[model samples]
Target: MKLQSTPPIPASDRQSPPAVLTLGPASCDAAILAQLLPVAERFRLNSAHLDPGGLVGWLDRLEALFEAEGRSVPVVVDLQGAKMRIGRFPSIPRLPGRVELVPGDRSERADTIPVPHPGLFRHAAPGDRLFLNDARVELEIERVGDERIGARTVRNGPLEASKGINRAPHPLPFEALSDRDASMIDASIGRPFVEYALSFVRSAQDAGLLRPRLGGHRLIAKLERTEAIAHVREIDAAFDESWLCRGDLGAQAGVGELGPIQRRIATLIPSLRNPCYLAGQVLEHMTHFPEPTRSEVVHLYEVARSGFAGVVLSDETAIGRHVAEVAGFLARAAPEE
Candidate 1:
């Protein structure tokens, strides 16, 4: 769907840091959508969750609503960007034992795990470590085969299906833009208010692979990999904006190292080519409950006071039960400007 020409924002409101809210299946509710729109300066759609058609439907409604008010909120489509993930199978109750990683999106046996990407099978080796479900579970590869790899859990925990997969020290070899990402990008073309974000950016070169396909939309680089942080200056020059995705970064960098990594990014904020936004787990407590923890509230305030241009809420606003309360709290806590 083509967007109508957007109305101008009042100059007085431009200086304040913009709150970018991500939309999920839950946001399809009209009342919930209404509650969310007012508090957010921008909206984000995850291509992994919402298909191209759904994205268009969302933009149609959002654009119409904002146009009626003589204003517009920018829309960002966050591409999956080769994020490796395990496929469907029964949730593992005992994850410590031997498991076989097989091809495709499903496994018939409980002891077997399914991973859809061929790069995993080709690149995996003995003794390699794999982090699953945001690093909640860890696996050590014991054998590699043409069809699958044998692994044993290093960190034992219950595992669910369709969770994120990562290999440290040696990342998987997935393309920078998946076919789904390309399709979503095509869906977003011709809409002036629409922008695109590349996830799991490892370096300026990774951003280079995606920039040409964005059709002139502003590209935001999600600095989730340690490699990306190491080459932040090059990335700063390549992308229009940057986002510090703490959740993934923590998983990749280890929780103990995340703070230092963030401080490193914080130190380089002045040298960055464009605005860098903070993302992931900002209002995590509010995801399952009504109120954010005191620390979370303080964290939001501190992030605003820090050099970040804005913040992005992941599960907090996407699937949280207390959407209105979360939005209100952010508005009260940060009070943009």
Candidate 2:
């Protein structure tokens, strides 16, 4: 596919768009983070993957690292709330022919699987569908018992075990922020220049629930689900900023549908005069190679022409081998403002 041509970058404004870089378990080393910071204008620490204690330690280390550099950077904490995920595995398991997800069963297996999150059973019901591994696999809940759920795979694929799960149909009647997320929000209340990204936001009410608890920090909503897309007008009316989570949205609606949705959102969310970030796989190939693929370069160019506020790096910078090089590539390729 031909990428939309990117506008020329002016000589005066050579810097890239405001990019947000994720720093997590994979890229938590001090030296690596220090090297990445100069290229990254913002740092995002995922609270979903880290426990409260781990989150605290990460915040402390990042703060110390920034202090040593004599630079203050924007820090964003992403909360993993009611989003469903597969139980942890010792490693990323190879795809199985078929996997059955039964609640409370924690044993690793080829056909039958366990869901460790007790909350899934508590919140989800029979007839509701579960999206796993970025929605590559689909399962329909046939029955729900006290602690176990009986689900059959409707759609199956080669899943890299332990990836996050999303619910299909509509929003579940659960809190947007988990107890652990609330604590992180509480602790980060007074910190200067910190931003909170609420993931899987389905409605304006979800954003409203966060306002009281979050003491002066900026709130950025991550619109990653079908429900959020349906309610984009309401959500846009509520939150000042939002992220177009192409990866998650692609899971809900096929990747082919992402472009129009992104463009519609950019037009709808005016408060977010800031560019909406095109996330997930922006430079996925760079995880293995030192250089980005031509297709990835075209994708980046398309993102630039789309006029987003910024492009975010996930595995590309957080765990990839060529973190700085990828950042430099993006900086060089971004359309000049």
Candidate 3:
């Protein structure tokens, strides 16, 4: 297969912080990618969200587009790690008004939803909370049954298929990488992929466990949990790079400490010679607005001052009204002029 062309790196980009633009959530779609890539070509957000299952199709299409346009970009595959996801249930006439958590990896029945791991059963109890899809949907367990747990929703919104599930920050006796993540890495054995975004890294063990799977690929240890923060130095040493993913980190570090902790982590990585990326909520307001908020402007300056090698966007580029505009502002902030 023909590799996409590697464009000359301008002196400006060499001196500026690199930005990686993400494809839209359903960005896997060929048409959506068609719309997004032209913008990516212009702004040069080299790194993109590459996951396992959809890797080949996206690469084929991306290669065609970039080859046609005469460009190439780095691919970063983000591993889901041991983060828990609500299991699949067949669609009912309507989802139960009551939320349910049943055991197993999948379900096709009514009312009872699948929670997959039996280990979670030990931690959960009545009146405890369950956060689904990054807290977009909340389930407060009213009662726990022998077979299933039932709850009522506190926050209701659009829920994605395979949304993540979590309670509070408690240490699970498991490695950060999930079986699924390992299989994914194994599948990508010979692809010239650039990096692995190892998720849920909580300790040096978490980082070390994944380093071998990467097969010498760049490792971006995502510091999302407080445990990762507590042991940042070792985790930093174990990986080639680090990322401060504020969304999940907020859950692990307490929302109050997300900002301070993000700054602190960003400050630490540069001294270790491990470049860090500031991800999440960088241009969140731009998803709706024509212009960036004053705070967003300040946030960019904070990123640069703290020595982040790059900034990452999720909604701002993926689902934002102005994907290219958001990319432009980010480029301006850390100009590749």
Candidate 4:
């Protein structure tokens, strides 16, 4: 009945390269890596979560511990590039009527929530589903205009402010790098494994822009956008590895495309032999639940079976309650060695 435990990983499997399990930035315990040094494949730090000083401290500690323990994992910093987010809105625990999803600024009216970016409206149309923050709060776009977007909640739940907004894949165009991303990359220079992972990469050109910022460190092209997948080979060539950030992909990809897309990318990475990892909503419910759902287990197994180098956990470890347990599942859950 234990959801966390799968069949034991065969001895041969344990000897193989451990699946690269990535923990998110919210996992500031810093020492968690040392504790699970053998389990983790990489640690992901977000720019918004820590300043330059804090990052250096954690990196130093983990690297030093690895040296002493003869164990180490790469630390990947997400530039948050091309991650479109909505502006601040009140915690609408329940539904609000006729909310004006405004653009360019926050709204004074309680009924309004601005999405500073104008591009969201450009590609989105009436009836397109919008997922805010998480899948909990879904909106069906009823109106898209020059000034505001109006959507009625499809799945009523609490809505948080300043979280990412994901719409159906509809040519949602934008630059890959922000000025802030450049600054973080500049600040992260010289740190071990301060390697840059560009999110929502659309094309090889987008991935190419990050090389200068990477300072010759590894470049991980995260394929989430539908556009990016279209140019998968070019982007794959432009970077050292590929990343399947499925949570965003689910939100951005058409519902039907999700399955085929996952299969294609999962199939594509192994052939490239570029140390790819699968992430997003992998263990979403395991944060509080004692065991993961049936679907979650199958998904993790699929990741392991894909013959990729690793799989990643975002919220599962970042803000989730059961970080270690989930990592234990991935670290230990392998097929035959």
Candidate 5:
């Protein structure tokens, strides 16, 4: 199915706005809740790095926090689906030079490395590309051997392990949930007030697997990969809601291409009638500094003007020290009559 345009934000509802914020387990503390929940429309708990036990507690705190304020906020639990990524090293030095990917290197200190994901080796071939650290750097598969795959930097940057890795040119043949993600999903079952965000949905098949796991709750497919873009219509047909994850998207398609992709996704996902959010780096400064950048503010307005349903503040709210300030900024910056 072709994508459709988002309905205009109702003039009446424009007077009040909805902005979504993602909170990490650490950020779910009562202090942060006291300042954030009243203004946020939704809270996304990212399950990528969080342990199962920690996530449960985060959910509990989220409920109590909202209740204390005499309001109920929607909770989105983002499952770390079948996306391929490198595990973290003890301390990844900020290498000034490019780190090559070599086969059979098990030691932690090797300049070239072997990722723990055996599936990556099985699927990646020469000429394919891999995205690292939100696409800040690119690694090209130079060779595919019996035991491993070799890659070289196409774009130069310092990379640490545990930064996300994605294959390019073709989608990998595998389930969306890694073993760790499966564990997280199992732990999250039967949780109240939690919606599931399925990441890297490339086709209807991906959505099909996710639907059964969702246990009758809402599932929002996060469309980020090029394959997902190509098969968006099918994925949209399979799921009720979608989020255009523009951060990893910019990495896959370059920053310049993001706008058109966003427009296209907004058009295709009929259920996503709100502003297909232009997420990632919207308030990156707030992650370290207490204030948002002027450019970030402009981008936020751009997203609002485009009529996005909501914007997600990931690292800005999750790990950042300025969670409350970022939440407040989005609440105030949102379009209000």
Candidate 6:
């Protein structure tokens, strides 16, 4: 599909702390992608959402589109590494009540949420806290049974299927590289523009283990686990870059603590060797509105001041209502450049 030809982005309009655009289902639409791609400094694709073949096809299209533009943007194939997600279940209108947790990808019952990852069951215990759907819903474990675990929602909210699950303070007993991640990385070989971003990274060793598989492609360590923050220096050294994914980080740490955690990491960026980018929920309100909340704009400038090399827009650019407007806002807010 030919992208409608457009003028090149002006140097001044390019964000100072560059903006990385994350691709989602909505981004697959040609019209939507045409509106979003030019302003992006880099592209991020979640591996879980696309199979190897489909991903290559998407990459081909992206390359073609960029070829038309006379420039290319690096693509980051985001690996799901060690992240635990609940499987498919009908959306619950109201949460905060007791729910059952079982292991599988599909749950037929409304009260049951499929965890699908055995590591969670093996490590979870009574009284442990579980955060789901980015901590909009919080669960307190009531019992850990042989086949199913029981949890009561301490915080009330709606629940959705296939959302991320985080058990913080207690490390999830999963390795950094999942089988799917390994396969996807292997499939991505020989693609010069393709790089890998490892998710849920907890230690430098996790980054170390995945390094050999990339054949020296640049790796970006996503620091979401609270455990990772303590070892940020070592982890930073292991990767070409690091992403401070505030969404899961906030979910793991208390949401109320995200600001403090982000600021603390900001102070450490100057000491780190690799570039660190602020990610997750930047200009989130733009997902539904044409303009971002004033506070969100202020936060972008604050991140720039904190020495973040860039900011990643997830839902904002992926499924947002005003994609071009969102990108323009980020560019206009660029720090003195």
In the range 202-300, model 5's lDDT, one tens digit per residue, is 777877776666778877778777777887666666776667788777777778988788787656545443224446776789998878888876666
| Number of the top lDDT candidate | 6
All candidates: TM-score: 0.88, 0.84, 0.78, 0.80, 0.83, 0.90
Candidate scoring better on TM-score of 2 and 6: 6
Runs off by more than 4 Å, candidate 5: 1-17, 96-107, 110-114, 174-176, 267-276, 334-337
Ranked by TM-score from best down, the candidates are 6, 1, 2, 5, 4, 3
Model 4 global lDDT (CA atoms, 0 to 1): 0.69
Clashes, model 5: 10
Whole-model lDDT per candidate: 0.79, 0.72, 0.66, 0.69, 0.70, 0.82
Q: lDDT ranking from best to worst?
A: 6, 1, 2, 5, 4, 3
RMSD of candidates 1 onward, in order: 8.4, 4.6, 8.6, 5.0, 6.8, 7.0
Query: Any idea what lDDT model 3 has?
Result: 0.66
Residue 244 of model 5: what lDDT? 78
Candidate 6 per-residue C-alpha lDDT over 1-337 given as tens digits, one digit per residue, 9 for 90 to 100: 9899899766644335688898877577776666666678898888766778878888888888787767788999988888877888788777637888998989878778898888888889999999888888889999998979999988877777777888866658446567777778877777899988888888888877887788889999998988888999999888899999989988888778888888888899899999999988888889998898878777776777678998888888766777778767765655454
**Candidate 1 residue spans exceeding 4 A from truth:** 1-17, 67-70, 91-96, 173-176, 334-337
Clashes of 2: 3
Question: Model 4 residue 233 lDDT?
Answer: 77
**Which ranges of candidate 2 are over 4 A from the true structure?**
1-9, 12-15, 95-106, 109-112, 116-119, 122-128, 154-162, 171-176, 269-275, 334-337
- Model 1 earns a TM-score of 0.88
- Index of the highest-TM-score prediction: 6
Angstrom error at residue 200, model 4: 1.1
Clashing residue pairs, backbone N/CA/C < 3 A, model 5 = 3-267, 3-268, 4-267, 81-176, 82-176, 82-177, 274-309, 275-307, 275-308, 275-309
